[model samples]
Each structure stands twice: as structure tokens, then as C-alpha cells.
Target: MIRSFAVAAIMAAIMAAIAAPVAAGPIEDAIAGSWRKPADKARDQYRHPAQTLKFLGVKPGQTVVEVSPGGGWYTEILAPAMKGNGKYVAGLANPLASVNAAKSVENFKTKYADKAIYGDIGIGTFGKGVADIVEPGSADVVLTFRNVHNWHMSGWDQEAFNAFFKALKPGGTLGVVEHRLPEGRPDADMKKSGYMKVSYVKMLAEKAGFKLAGSSEVNANPKDTKDYADGVWTLPPTFAKGDVDRAKFAAIGESDRMTLKFVKPK
Candidate 1:
């Protein structure tokens, strides 16, 4: 009877192990960091920082360049994750590009100057025929989050992709997370709405000499009806419509995002 009880206890322990949540790794640790604002933490439900980084293949010791890191949301996680072993380069428009772009980069640097939290982050440049964001073939990973639409609006989408392609090492990764337009939508909608077509984005990258590697729905939202009055800004974070249908947008959450990976041939 004692042996029978012992066997049952062992089986129970094994089952418990299987049921346990995944142990926090470096990326997870960075996402759970105390330095991140509560507001930023709340977005993790939609952002899925840990899973997104894993999909992008961001690893320690890699030279990671984040293009147009608006508000430094990912910077908060990446800086700490890369503090000791790697570099975090923030690629924004060069200070000479425009007043707003210059101020934005300045504000970002001032906001993230804390070495204890953000490490020694570097600055790189793109846009406005400003040239490379980093040295040719220097970066292991180049990530752009939801900023592609702005480039499209600027009519420099091709230039931006060319810059990204130039910045990456051969066999390196270019990870893009952008608001997605449905396949059936008119291509012109991309210019009006903030969302873009996967095919169009792929064409841009391919024009810049990148081969598609993979794509993920980790940030997909089926509830986004994609016909908002103010485009994607009509959603929760922007709530462009003010109180009108705020609850409806809140329930819908963030826009559906396409998480794509492209590779520079070795």
C-alpha cells in the first residue's frame, strides 16, 4: 500500500511540472522589469513583448537597431535585456531631417538616458534621403514597429526599406510589426488608413533585396472591423473619435498587426 501511494504521488508531481507556466527567460525578465511604466505593462496584453521578440529572433549579444522607436515602448524592454552583452541602437530620422524629427530623437534620448535601465543605447538615422541608419551590414536585427505607414505616407517607403536592407548583415533579420490591411481591401486604403497590405510591404522589401522568411499572427486582432472613421487611430490607444463608441473600440482592442521576418541573403 505504501508503494502504491508513493507511485501515485510521483505521478501527481510529474503532472504538476507539466502544468507549470514557462519559466521566465532573459526576454521575459526584461518584459517583467520594474523600470517599465504601468501603462506600458498594461499594453503587454496586446503587444506580447516576449513572444514577439522570440519570433523576431532577438537574442543577447546581437546588435539590434529599432527604427523609429516612437515612445520607446520596446526600448524599455530591449535596453535592459541588452545592457551587458549587446548593443541597442535607436534608428530615428537624423536631427537634420526636420524640427519634429530632431526633437523626437532628443526627447527619446533624454527619456532613455538611464544606463541602469536602458543601457548605452546608440542613435542611427533614416528617412529624407538621409542615408543609412547604421553602417552597411553592421546590424544583426532591424525592427520597425507600426512606423511603416508613416513612411508610406511620406512616399519614402521604398527608401526606408532600402535603408533597412543596407543596415543588416547578410543572413541577418529585418522584423516588421505593422498594422495590417485585409487582403481584399483596395490598395488606396493603405494611404488613407494606417493599415497596410502584407503583399505591398513584401514587395517593398523584395525591391530592397530582402527575402521573406516568416510571418506571425501573435499580434492579430480579429475584432478590428478595419473601417474606423479615423482609421486605425480610432482604436483604444488613440480613440480618435473621443467618447463616441470608445467602449466599442476598447472591446476591439489594438489593431491587427502583421509580424513579419525578412532575411538578407548570405
Candidate 2:
């Protein structure tokens, strides 16, 4: 039987649609999964998880260590993405440093105990004077998200970088996402404010013998002028000021960030 010409065309179009493959792969699928907390998913607009990870050369089957996963923001994504294929290790905080640090390590384990969701996430230590977050030269990638400022504040940012370098295999990658302070800002602000200059971050990596491979603006936010009284926390999420110019800060969204990729020398 001969069908109408328009009906044939419509059927052809339907076939084409069914055959076309989805461009987003496992990384994107993991980010969209329902297992992640709603609050964490909402921050994707500012975090740009998939894009940043892609730019950093993350792939399945490679060991990746997430340094000092404060509250596991990236953990939700990294753990699931690496499940069954790669190693996902959390470089835990230094309990010897403070009482809270000890509790943080314990809380992270409990929070991510559901293997059905997080997989087998190994644990290790990362802090001042103690940086072996994994077996030396074991990880293929070492990712630190917005935690550099904390080490800088604690006067051990270099130690953290040295540890990252030690953990990664030769030729491995180190992906860093951090709130950015403008270069014009005084160096002292890096300690007090929750931000670091891109140059300063690069210097730390270089000093640790890692070469800067590339950088991405995937997480950049121009709305952040980087002069908030409460630092990056003045924006949404933290709102450190607590209702002071709340609407204004909300409009600004998250802080501007610099995403960098460095490589440990072979």
C-alpha cells in the first residue's frame, strides 16, 4: 500500500531521531543521576562538574584521589563515575591537626557508606607535614576543588601540592578548581579570604614540580567582583553575612573561579 508523501517523510524523521546517539556520555549521565543530593545538583550551574572534569582529562579506569573532600561536593559525582571501572579515593583531613578534622574524616565515611551509591571509596590522609593520601605514585589523577584556600590559610598550601604530586603517577594530571582572587589583590588576602590568584596557584604547582598543562573557564563567574566583605562565602550557599544584602549577593551567584590542569612530570 502506498502511504501519503508527508506520512513517509514523518516516519523517516522518526527513524532518524531514534538512530541518533546521545552526545552526553557517562560523565554527564552520572551528574544527572538521581543519587546525588538535590542541593549538590543545584550547584552544578556554578560548579560545571562535567565540563571541568572533561577539560582535566578524567576517564574511567584511572585512579583519582579527591583531596580533602569537605562535605563531598565532588565526591557524589566522582565516586559514581569511577564505580566498577576506576579507583575513587578520598584524601581525608589531618585528624592530628584539630578535633573537628578527626570528626570530619569520620563523618565522611559514614555519609558515603552506602556502597550502592558511592562504591568502594578508599581513604588516606592529606594535610601539613603528612601528604601521602594514597600509595606514593599510585593515582592517575589528583583533583582538588576549592580547597587550596584552606591549605593556604593553614600555611601549608605547598605541602598539599607536594602531596598531590607524590600521589599521582608520573605523567598523571592534577585538576584544581578554586575561588579566584584578582592578581591585584594583596598576597595577604589569600590567607584571610577564601580565594587564591591563578598565578599563585600555578606557582605552587610548579614549585612542586608539576607542569601546568592547561586551564579552563568552565567554572568562572564574572559577576563575582572578588571584594566581598565575607569573601567568597558572601555569595549564595555560604551567605556568610547572614541576610545582609542577601538579594544582592544571590544575584551575584557563586564566586569567580579558576580551573587549572597540571601534570606531574614523567
How do the residues 49-122 of candidate 1 rate in per-residue lDDT, one tens digit apiece? 98899999999899999998888899998888988889999997688867987898889889998898878998
Most accurate candidate by lDDT:
1
Clashing pairs in 2: none
Candidate 2 lDDT over 1-266, as tens digits, reads 35788899999999999999968666777899898889889999999888899999998898999887888888888898888889899998777889999999889999999998788998988877895888999999999998899889978889889989989999999999999998998999998889999999999999999999999888889889888777888898999999889999989999899999999889
Instruction: Report the poorest 10 consecutive residues by lDDT, candidate 1.
Output: 125-134
Candidate 2: 10-residue stretch with minimal lDDT: 21-30
Q: Cα RMSD to native, each candidate?
A: 2.9, 3.0
What TM-score, to 2 decimals, does candidate 1 have? 0.91
